[model samples]
Structures are given as C-alpha cells and as structure tokens.
Target: MQITKPTFYNEFSCIAGSCPDTCCAGWQIMIDQNSLKKYRHCKGAFRNRLLNDIDWKEHSFRQYQKRCAFLNEDNLCDIYSEAGKDMLCDTCRKYPRHIEEFEGLRELSLSLSCPEAARIFLSHKEKIIFRTVEKETPEETYDDFDYFLFTALMDTRDYLFSVIQDRSVPCALRRRKLLACGHDFQLCLDQNELFQWETIRTRHQNSAFGDSFQKKIFKWKDAEKSSDNLRKSIWKTIIPQMEILRSGWHDYLRDTLTPLYTSCDTEQQYQNVCLEFETFYPDWKIQEEQLLLYWIYTYFCGAIYDEQIFAKVKMAVVCTFMIHELAVGTWLLQQKQFSFPDLVSICYRFSRELEHSDQNLNKLEELLDWEEIFSLGNLLEI
Candidate 1:
C-alpha cells in the first residue's frame, strides 16, 4: 500500500491541555465497538468511570453542555488523563488524524477542525507537495468498486493538481477550470461513457477551446449580479441548512457578517470594504489555493464509490469560497484589522461545523445540485 500525504502532514502534534479550542467539546464522540468491548471489561479504577461516561445505547460518550463527558475542566481528555492513551477510543485516539481508505491505499490527513492542525495548514505558505510512501500492509477488496471510474478519477485528480498548483495561472482561472473539468467528468460518468474520460481530461489539460471557454465564462459572469449578491448568497444560504453544532457558531456568523450587513449598508461600501480586504490580506490567495487543494484532495477521489464527481468538485469550490467570504467578514468585524490567528479560527471552526457532521455534508452536496446560488455560473461570479 502507498500512503500519500502533504509535506506538513507529519508535523501535527496535539497541544492537549495547551489548546484553547479542544476538539472533544461541542461534538459527540462515538465509541467504536472494539473500544467498547475493552471498556466493558476494564479493570478496577477507570472501569466505573468509563461505564458511566459511555452512552451504551448510542455507543457514544454522553455530553454535558455539549462537552464530552470525559473532557475535564482543563479541556483535556479525562480518559487520557487517567486511563492512558491506549484506553482512548479509535476516534479520540486518531483525531484530528483523519484516514480515508481505498483498495490498497490509506490517505491520511490532519483534520482542520483542530486549531493546532489549522495553524499548520495556514502557516505553510508554499504550494503543497504530496509525497507518497510505500508501506507493506494487508489488502482488502470491495464488493462493487468502480475500478475503471476510480482510475479515471485518479488521473483527472492529477491533472486538477497541475492546474491548481500552476501559480502562473490566476487562482480564479484555476477554480473555474476545476469546476469546469468536474462538470465534464460528471457528464461522462452520467452518460455511462467512461471511455470518454481520457479525451475530456486532455481537452481540459490543454484546452483546445480555451478562447471559447474564456468567452463563454466571461459573458456568463458579466450577467446582473453584484458583490453584495455573492456575499448574501454564500453567507445566508449555508446557515439554514447546517446542523449548527455550537451556539457560538450561530452568534459568530451573525456578529462577523454585521460588517457586510450593517456596517457597510450599501453596495459600494460593501465592495470598497472587500477591496480594502484584498490589500489587507494579500496572502489570502495562497490560503485560498491551499484550501481548494485541501478539499479536492481530501474528498475528490472518494467519488469513486457514488460517482457524484461534479457534486464533490462543487463542494470543494463552494467550501473554499465560503471560507474566503467568512475571512472577509471576520476582517470587517475587526475594523479591517486581521491577524494570523483569525485565519486559523475561521478554517478550523468551519471545518468543525461542516465536516464533522455527515448530515451537514449530505445536505450541502445535495443543495449544490439544485440550488440556484450554487449554479456553475453563480459560483464563477462569486
């Protein structure tokens, strides 16, 4: 098996008690069956504690005020504090280390939901480089794996990386091309014409209709829409659909967006504040590139199972843009004052809200297909 990860992948180390924003709180921690077995038969001191803490019916830890039952006042895992690291459940032990499994591969990444891991991502300014290391491991087979489509997705992902990492091209163009390619791939899959993938990928790689696509997209973007529309669409549309994990997240969005909604109060004021933000946070482009690549890399190939390739790509595009908009709102809230920690908070908090919940993910992807705001043209305009 081969393990592929970013250069900074191995740099993640949990800050534990030092972390102000602990992952254990605000989300239900599921206890795996294997860990449950261990807990049920546990020895003296910690056994009763585990039994009381574990919600047997739910196979998860009970939460008091949304904080995990095991989370102590210092925001440290009480299980680790008393029972030792080995006693932690699979989820707790591995987080924020996330693993995505394929036939003979395991793609491991540190979740951005952890503020520490978010710092690692935002701090690394260079273009991301993926390094694959071969590791000997047992292989498993799937009942109905779409090997051919998976191969196509793999090859297309490589091409996507090329376009995204090509700093010579503007980030906007990279994003536009990514969504365009995803749409094309999705069409081929829907038509049951997997044979056409090679041709489609090549066409996008060295676009023969470059001039035509530019003209088409340019005209589409020039349609009647303003920055205010983009802001409202991205901000207002997401909140209602999400399973708000924290009340703070609800208040956070309302408070941060007050700039665009109240302080600016006019189209020109909104646009001017946004323009000033570009100058205020010039490295946003770098962060944007990283976030797009992060989402794409993490979830793109997983479409091999469901073959909803376009939805996956749209998700990547939408999420990256959503975070960028949030960054703008946060900056505005601070009266144009932005700092490194602000970026980390925005990235991790968004990850916690969206990525942590399967329901939110499904609702988000479903909306991307039928939502007027997520239409390809609207996304480009945004």
Candidate 2:
C-alpha cells in the first residue's frame, strides 16, 4: 500500500474552543453505524443524553440551529471530553483529513476547510509537495481496477501541479492549458485508445500545445466588451445557487460589485475590478491557480474510471473561479480588507457547503452535463 500527503499536511492542530467558528456548527453531523451502536449500548447518564441528542430517523446528531448537540458552551466537543478522543466516530476523528482511495492507493490530503490546515497551507513560503510512503501489504487482492491508468494518473497529477505552480506562466495561460488538457484527455478516453493517451498527455506536459492555447487567450484578451453579456448571464445563473448560503448574499453581491463598476460587462471596468482585487490580496491569483490545480489534478485522472470528463473539469473550474469571485466580493464588502484567517474561513465554508453536500454535488454534476451552461471557455470569457 502507498500513502501520500502534502508537505504541510501534518502542521494542522484543531483550535477546539479557540476557533472563531466551530466546525460543529453550520452543518449536519452524520453519525456512523459503529458510533450509533456504541452510543446505543452505553449504560451511564451520558447515554441518555446521547440518545436524546441524536435524531434517530436521520442517524445524525441533533443540532440547535445547525450547531452540533455535542458542542459545549465553550465550543468544545463534550463527547470527546467525557468519553475520551478514542470514542469519537470515524467522521469526527478524521475531519480535515480528506482521503482519495483507489486500487492499492490511499491518497490523503488535509482539507483547506480546517482553519489550522488553511493556516499551514497559506503560511508556507514554498510550494506544496506530496510525500509518499510505500510498503508491502501482507495480502494483495485483485479487482477490475486499472493500476496502469492509476499510475499514469498520478504522474499526470504531478505534471499538472508543476504547470499550476509555475510562476513563469501567467495564471490565465495556466488555466487555459489545464482545461485544454482535460478536453483532449476526454477524447482519448472516449475512443478507447488508452495507449495513445500518453502521447496527448506528453504534448500538454511539454508545452507542445501551449503556444496555440496562449495565442487564443492573447487574442481574446485584446477584445473589448466581448465577454460582457456572457459574464452577466453567468453571474445571473450562479447567483441563484448562493441561496443555500446565508440570506442577503445576492444583495451583498450586487451592492459590492454593481456600484463599484456600474456593470460587470465593461472590459476596462472589469480589469479595474481585477486590479482592485489584486491590491486587496496581492497573491490571490497565484493562490487561486494553485488551488485549482490541486483540485483538478486530484480529481481529474480518477474521473477516467467513471468517464465523467466534463463534470470533473467543471468541478475544478467552478470551484476555483467562484472561490476567487467570492473572496474578491467579500473583501470589497469589508471595505477592501482581508486577512489569512478570513480567506481560510471562506475556503472551509465554501468547500463544506458544496463538496460535503451530496444534494449540491449531484446537482452540479447534472448541471455540468447540460450543454447550455458550465462552459469553461464561456465562463472565463476565453
């Protein structure tokens, strides 16, 4: 078996009561079967409390206004304090520790969702690196999994990260190349020509198609107001999705953006907004690019097995793009000020809202399939 983690993966330590917001709030905490069983057989006073605290129909801890039942007044987990850390469920114990499992591989990453994890990630001066630990397992079982494709996927992920973290290339170009790679990779997979996949992968990895992609982007960059109508339409479509979040976000979006520029359609005005965004978070573009790369690379190759090519690309693009937009919008709303803590808070909240919710994910996947929306080139105005 092989296990891999990012270099900063081990730097996180949950703040418990000291956090500005607790993870125990703002989401349903689903109890595992084993934890449910353990809680059922308990023979102490706490057992009654546990039984009362859970909503048996949902098999989840009951919440007060979305806050976990186990959450104490001080924002600490009372269950952990009373029953010891060992008694916590798998979900509870493994939070912020995201796992991507494949045949004989378990890739672990510390989710940027945790404030501590975000701190460790953003505080680092160097690029993130993946470290691998490999040892033989006592028994090897067989399945229909493609180990060769998996190996290729891992290599492709590494190469994709290199492109993303390459500061020499502009973020716009990096994104263009990444999306093109996904589009081409899909073609190969669709034709059942797995052997020819390496050739296409190498072309992108070695900048073989990068020059043409760059030319297209440069051409589009000079065009004025060509993307205005597109941006407005997309903004209109996406704003509705934010209804799942706190109310007033729609007004917040318009108030912060519309007055500043009069319209999202104006090219120079949008450029100015981008400039303002850069000023507020100077390295936000690079950070956003890196994050997009991380997510795309991690999920892209595995998506081959499921053959959901466009959905994977859409997931990566939408996540990174929306995150950048929200961060920019939120900072502007706060009078053009933001800090690492605020950025981390936004990252966690966004991911928890989208990635951790099945209803949302399934909806997004369905939306990805619809031809009228979820266009990478259209969304980016490329």
TM-score per candidate, in order? 0.95, 0.88
For all candidates, the clash counts are 0, 0
**Which regions of candidate 1 deviate over 4 angstroms?**
208-210, 219-222, 225-227, 263-271
Clash pairs, model 1 backbone: none
Worst 10 residues of 2 by lDDT: 241-250
Which pairs clash inside model 2?
none
Highest TM-score scorer: 1
What residue runs in model 2 are displaced by over 4 Å at the alpha carbon? 135-143, 208-210, 216-226, 238-265, 380-382
Candidate 1 has an lDDT of 0.84
Task: Give lDDT tens digits, candidate 2, residues 290-368.
Answer: 5785676466666747777656776777677766766776676677787777677777766766666667666666676
What does the lDDT come to for candidate 2?
0.70
lDDT of 1 by residue, 160-197 (tens): 88888788877888888888888889989889898998
Worst 10 residues of 1 by lDDT: 222-231
